[model samples]
Target chain A: MIALVQQDGPLRIEITEGVIEPLPFAIPTFQDESGTAGAIADEISRVIAADLSGTGLFREIPSTSFISSVTNFSAPVAYPDWKAVNAQALITGAVTESGGQITVKFRVYDVFSGAELGQGIQIVGTTAGIRRIAHKVADTVYSRITGETGYFDSRVVFVSETGPKNARSKRLAVMDYDGANVTYLTDSQSLVLAPRFSGSGDRLLYTSYETGQPQIYVMDVGTAERRALGTGGGNMAFSPRFTPDGQGLIFSLEQGGNSDIYRMDLQGGGLQQLTNSPAIETAPSFSPDGTQIVFESDRSGSQQLYIMGAGGGEPQRISFGPGRYGTPVWSPRGDLIAFTKQNEGRFHIGVMRTDGSEERLLTASFLDEGPTWAPNGRVIMFTRESQGSDGAAGLYSVDISGRNLRRVPTPDSASDPSWGPLQN
Target chain B: MKKITIAVMLVSALALTACSKNRFNGQDGTAGAGTIQPGSANDPSSPAYFNQTIGDRVLFAVDQSTLSAEAQSVLTQQATWLSNNPAYSAIVEGHADEQGTREYNVALGARRASAVQSFLIERGVAPNRLKTVSYGKERPLAVCSEESCYAQNRRAVTVLTSAAGS
Candidate 1:
């Protein structure tokens, strides 16, 4: 329950309580000499409005309801006109084009308090960059008001699927986390299962069936060039994951009909077998310190989770609950392990402490698994498949508290989401 | 409870048919037929006591690396069969539901196969004769959008590459 009251000098402010209503804001159209430029300004404002309003965190006042027009972009905003419409905040901008470059200048005002919040200017390569420029402006305003970092600039990498159920085609696609700027990194002809970002978000490691067998491949995000890491033989190799340091890869290799967990140096040519058992052991994720690995195994006649030292000692079973657990990924924070749990025909995405205690089921549905941590470790993004006439798989994000479940937008069906480390 | 009963019945039917198929296949010299004596456990008439096919797999719930009681029973039967035919070596391939992250699913698959291996060892089957690997949702016998298909995909399969009586 925070409220802002304006004062003079550097837009001084004070907070109050009692009314926690949304801070009213007005975004007037940016003045432009050309109609196209005006249209671009209008669209940018619309995107900003959409982004802010969708969060359920802001209230936008309509210009039609305004008492006065913002005709002069450079002139001081008539605070009374904005206050008359009950808009606590006012945003004004102008678009200017020179030598094939577009520049947008914008300012924020606290209308009721009659003070300016901030002002910014952005130059873009083309009019297309206008939207992103607007996004940056909106992010600045929102952060100033809410006191939190904005996610508008981040991107998401997921597996985009098509074709029928039996022979689905998958490719790696990356876009703004909000589903804009969709770009496919790999051609859809190959079957790409999971695409996980390296620590730097500049590269990706994923499983591809391009060679008719599941093999791990690493691709540069910028160049889209891929190189096979391990020399995959007749045996299938799948589920390649990067060590926290990004210097080694942990993956499952099927040799002589047996699948075992192996770690290989990303640069050097040494493969180390991490687990040697008759039971299937795969999906190894390193602890933050790279000292222990948490993975799923069926060593106890059921598929349960186990943790062991990175050097391949005996594993201690961590899951003792009512159902089977799989896909244990260590959180980047090193406090919990996220996994998928199946019980009584329902699949769940859950997290438990590193020792397998304090298991909390974050989501439950017909089919939900694959929990990847947000770069900040506050939220998890996973794929949820609904069962019905329109049974489809899509990417979904949920707070670790099991609240704020929201669908991440994608052009087609998406799954196996891997949240990259925060962008630089 | 009703669903569980039906599932039990279905499992029984599948086990009976699987056992008959194993006998027929063994007689055909896919592998020499070795008598699979039911170990001391539950009722002999129960499907759990029947000798299961050596090279078969059991489905798991999505993301579940834990073996169900049904899966444990199947592995027990497999262990008895393996011990009786000591020359045979097996590879357990673990898999996961397609709904998961693939790397984690591979680990989950490995857990599933390892669960079977430990169960076989507890039942007197030598651990050295068995090997485990995880497919992690890479291979699918049934490809559909339905839960049934996903359940079948999440599994650990014991593949007998060598004949038991060789």
Candidate 2:
């Protein structure tokens, strides 16, 4: 909870319970400044409401319960009417469309203090980008109220699956963080797995068996143009991730029946071998600072999480739990690493400190793997395959606290989710 | 299971003798009648015959890549088949029961395939004739969720292809 002092009045305080009790907010349908705005204004308002409500931090006051509605964009705030309904925050917006360009202007108000939290701003984009405008508005409102950067503006890249358990077809698909506006980046001609976004979100790194073997590929997200990373032939590659700077790739390559981690410079096209051992070493992820790499290995006899210097040196084992741990992803905040644990015939999604202490399992199921962090590091999303022969894979998201576990709706079976950073 | 294996062996032996009888089958007309007996494990045209009759796969225990006595028996047979079939190379595709993380399962699958490869090499199969690929849990042999199906799914299958160098 955060306490905000009224900027318009003298020392009047208001408490915003962002987590305990969701702050009550109302978003009246945006006014269409031009008749050509069509239904985009209402659609944008709905997306904004959905984004805020999905966070579990805001309770939307239905339009029917509203005591008052603002029909004009420049109208004054009726604080008493909103306060009567126990609404703590109010959002107002207007949309205009001209020459195929759409502009959305919005303002957030503290209903109790009757103060505009900040100056209203207008964002313009193509009409096709109206959803992004809505997300921008929600991001602004969320940031202003909670004092935290909003993740609504981010995107997710995941594996879209179809067909049966024996012969499933998978392709790379990208969508908004809320699972809207999905666009397929690859066809199902070849099997694809674990699509990860570069820090800039302009490119994707994933494993593909298009050439009759598993190999890593980097694709431009916009153009869908892709090229495979050179593995010098007679070697198999998978489990690829980008460095924080997005200038390098760290991945696992198997040659002569031995799997080890390696790093490749995206520009220089040179490979740096990271780990050398007879045991299997895969699933390498870099620390937030790129100073160290955490990966899974069977070098210690069972699959365990380990950390080593980025330049590849003596590795220290981190996880000492009973189960085998793999798919370790360092959180953006650098304090925690999320992984999938298999124990006693059950799979779990869990988090632990960098030192391997305070290990907490957030989810347990028949299968849950491939954990990816939200841009804000407050949430984690992973693939959860249902139990049974008819069971299908689905994408699920959970807050770091393990509350608010929700399935992200997808058109078909989804897996290998990798949430991209917030778009610029 | 023992009866089924014996029945399959008897049927294959009968088919091998029938196919050995000289007849010009258009499928392999380029070769002489007895050059390619495209039946049973001895037939070059029927990889399925080798897969089913000669046993192209070895199953493993859950989460254990170390070959059991039964898996070793199967691999011994596979090694013998590979030794006799010198024109073919085998790609060992390792698969797991759908029970673990994708990345770890891939590594586990690799270990399983490598185990099979190493065992075959020790059994006199040429190392250069063997390659390994792990499909992880992505491809399952059986769709059922029970142990009966998972046992079949946790396997390393030796798929034979014509040796590129040969």
> Which candidate leads in TM-score?
2
Residue A374 lDDT (model 1): 72
**Model 1 spans > 4 angstroms off:** A1-24, A33-36, A83-89, A110-113, A118-125, A231-235, A253-262, A268-339, A350-361, A388-390, A421-424, B1-166
* Per-residue lDDT of candidate 1, residues A217-309 (tens digit): 887777677777764554567767788888888877765445678889877377888889866677778898899998887778767899989
Tens digits of lDDT, candidate 2, A23-125 = 7789999999998785999999999999888876678999899988898889898989988997778899999999999999999888878788889999999
Instruction: Tell me the docking grade of candidate 2.
Output: incorrect
Among all windows of ten consecutive residues in candidate 1 chain A, which has the lowest summed lDDT?
A8-17
Ignoring the other chain, what TM-score does chain B have in each prediction? Answer: 0.65, 0.72
Best lDDT goes to which candidate?
A: 2
Backbone clash count for every predicted candidate, in the order shown: 28, 0
Per-candidate TM-scores read: 0.68, 0.89
Top model by DockQ, which number?
2
